[model samples]
Target: MTELTDRYVWAAVRTVPEPQRSDLEPEIRELIEETVEAHLASGEEPSAAERAALVQLGDPERLAADYADRSLTLIGPRYYLAWMRLLKTLLATVVPIVTAVVFLAQFLGQGEVGAAIGGAVATALSVTVHVGFWTTLVFAILERAGATDAGLEWTPEGLPALPDHSRHGRLPDLVASLVFLGVLAGAVLWQQVRSVVRADDGSVIPLLDPALWSFWLPWFLALIVLEAGFAVRLYLRDWSWAAAVVNLCLALAFAVPAVLLWSEGRLLNPAFLDAVGWDPAAATGGGWTVASIITAVVVLIAAWDVVDGFLKARRASAPVPRHPVLVDH
Candidate 1:
């Protein structure tokens, strides 16, 4: 009868399919009228009674969904978060490794830069599509089947632990991480153009091997970009087990190659060392000693980084303690 009630009734029934709407409209109107009458009997004003009646009925669209026996979600609430978590984990872990492998294979087989890059990109996109489609389909099936009895039942023990609010990543930490990554990238590129050392002919010599420019340096830079993205993600959200695993993987990605190359004496430019007049074969066993030191530093740093990630995640996920209140007797 009132404008608010009329509008709510129309909104609700309009969403219900055709013939059902005809039956639902009058039934809904009757229910609202009954509620409004009850409120009026309680001494409420007509406008206030009608508004309270509509509020009591809750969201019209949800009511319509119930009347129509319709599901509003594709995957439903039961499996939605699980689906999202699995999808992200697959995309982040499997996709990158697949892309890198494809790129390496294509580049090695064809010896073509552009072709390798294009193929890798295409493969990555295809993999992403398949991953998303399959993941969504599985969750949808589980939702429609009402797979609660299929070992998918939730429990209090299964609930995610709350993060420690005080230990959460700060914006300043993100900024500092991004800045550090930028500086690292800049320093790597800068060494190519300007160097502190020079050859006998007075030509500037880069600190790192020019050979690394073809693959190693670029790959390292890409890992740095991934690290930056991880930092931003950490800043935006609380630390999780997934994030800690990602951090560990990133540390390995960065350190593994660097250690291998440095051990093989492929990391630093030989020309630069010669120009500096520092013989590795000196009495102090300078080259071996320096190489050992660098290797130890790289390994230790990577280990520390991985450990730190796990510790942070553990600390963040630790539950708050509930202390008992004491009353004086």
Candidate 2:
């Protein structure tokens, strides 16, 4: 056999059936000697012989790659741009679809057009962030698990039909969708709280407003509960959609207010307080403090999930070495 042919065989064997790794070195060396002997019998000139042999052997990496289908490694790092662009396109496309749906649904029982628009934006944000994140996260985990398989053609049970994912993604996506709904509920509750607590002047009232506070308390607690649920979902589920984006919003929700409240060191806007005849000094500046605390807790939990999810994904994609001994060891 030509030295090239031996290289091809050895490369294929070495690339796959990793449990055979320990055996491959000897087998490859033997193949090399046998091929060289046959070449010498042909009386190929010695000076040109080594060059021909090296050429025939080909590149090791190239040969190893040929043994397996290599669909996994095909995408590579450059595809990240294409990946981001595709999602952006999907989001842009989704926007119009959601708009049309909101417009049509408005006739049935949809709230104000403005509210409908805002709700759609919020829901889209939630689904895109959460569902997509969970999907990606689950796929990543399965992909990592798949790396353990040395056989070129081992079938992973319960793996999703889509490229690079497990079927288990469906459940995670559903849960994320629920989490988005929960966020929507929280926003609604917060909105109610704002309406009841803040006057047109946007200042807090000191006197007990039972009816308002009663409504506000349940809704406020509900928002916190919902955020906790969504955070937990993200922490546990796959990084499906822009799960990070929902997280981004959650982060901003806390960050922006905290900055606005504390950064300026102004509890209430002086002009706003004066117009409402409320003294800014008398007002409890604790609202920002409360919001900041809420945001801090939420951000902390969400950030941990983000970190954990990414680390899991990284482990999934890390370079996997094939070895024959691993099967037994």
Candidate 3:
């Protein structure tokens, strides 16, 4: 049996750049040597004929090109991928906590610390699901674009080429981000509690003080911001969870009843208004008027949010693979 030595592939691979030639040369040499040794085991010898034959197996230039691809990594693709993962983790952690706090406050009067933590975990999972789906779609497109005839390119310094693209969050998402929502909900509850506590003191405080109206108008704006944040998340492809819950709540609380009653043709009856504390027949209309107005508002808001979100998501990005390093191979 004859043995092949480094006399060698090293001399051949030395023609390439240090990055590819350094690491890859050794591996390629090892691979070829292994193949030759296996061939020798089948009664062939490490002769010049075999060497020339192996040279024809793959061109040196092509082998070097393949090695360069292995050395090169796309900074942007890798980074966005990792960044998206982190953002998902953060969203999953934050949004659900916000939802739970507000939900428990409405249903149980207040929220406990433990419940908030637990709910945060649930929210994190929810956020992960939405972000993961869109981000995966994005990377998949990137992968398709990055595939090459030479080979897959890659680099360790990834995704920093375009920091503007890094700002993946939408304005609506910012406004209605779970953190902002939770903060707004807490502020609202605090104000309500303060009002009640002060009222218990029997002070001569005006119930709907026109003076404090200016101060409270900010709260209204804050609520609008929270809703706006919700709108952004929807635009970013978050259709389930908050998006669904918000719309469903609006429909169940207003639209469905309004539509269903109207469908039955009994929602506007005089008896219906009177029972609900409205003088239907004596006035221009009845109880149905109140429900109808509220339902219209909810439906309008929901429709607006849905449409806006879709438009924004469509604008988030298109796939482009100009990165020199990083390939889908």
Candidate 4:
């Protein structure tokens, strides 16, 4: 058979179940070969015959859905609940929080009621569209990829004897983590380009050391990216030893830059302090004290997160007891 024949067969069965694919693939190939052979026998060119056979088979996605005995719908019944839950969660948590932040920032800076309301409305709508679009796109892809079917097969044996709720990572947590990270990264970069804090001389003062942009800031962002990656993995899989280990590594990674910035006493902008009315001497001492406290708090939180991950993973993996049934007295 021609390469086209193989491609056609693969396309048809790509989204079908694994066990079913083994049988369906060969059947599809056989049908295509027969159709192509019959066309060739009628004096059609080889290429033409292959093309005709594939065309007769119809769209690959539809064929796969037919073979799987399911409807070819975007976000079908199997994944519809999951999709709705995620959408509602994002709308409730990330959207409102982001909108509120934007409104407060605009209101505090511009001191205009109408402008703040308009900005907040605009931001809320934008966040909603992006969140809804991407979340739907992902779930749609999962539906087409037959992930829903794989998850739909359930047996009593597959159920955990005692479910560990802590280990069950919710989609909201993942979405929130990603949203918060995006906001944080955006704010960091935004502050650099245009300072939210300004001096009396009309000079813009960024919160962080602008010099750190060349190195330290990138390193800090990289750690945040790593943490985001872990969050995604946790969203996909249950908590485990490997995940906990990586969480600890990430905790340490986050602590390194924080410690360096604190020890070096260059974490915050001196100009920002002056903008806030602190004298030079007080700013120096106060900056160091604040940086030290913030660093300590961040390190402690990271450490606690690592410990929490391990504890949750251990709880998830613990063996559940099977109690014996008592005879009727």
Top candidate (TM-score): 1
Best by lDDT: 1
Clashes of each: 0, 21, 26, 0
Quote the positional error of residue 241 for candidate 4 in Å.
Answer: 0.8
Candidate scoring better on TM-score of 1 and 3:
1
Model 3: lowest-lDDT 10 consecutive positions: 279-288
lDDT of 4 at 328: 16
Pairs that collide in candidate 4 are: none
* lDDT digits (tens) for residues 1-329 of candidate 1: 97898899999998866878788999899999999999999999999999998999999999888877777789877787778778998999989999999989987997554566678889999999999999899888777666674555556797655432542526777889899999999999888888887776877799999999999999999999999999989988867889999999999889999998887889889988877766433322222354565577789988998998898788666664563122111
lDDT tens digits by residue: candidate 4, 208-274: 8888889889987887787788898888886788888888888787777677776676777777766
Name model 1 segments beyond 4 Å from true. 1-169, 200-202, 280-288, 320-329
Which of 3 and 4 is the better model by TM-score?
4
Model 1 vs. true fold: TM: 0.45
Candidate 4 local distance difference test against the native:
0.76
After superposing candidate 3 on the true structure, give the runs of residues whose Cα lies further than 4 Å from its correct spot. 1-165, 168-184, 187-290, 321-329
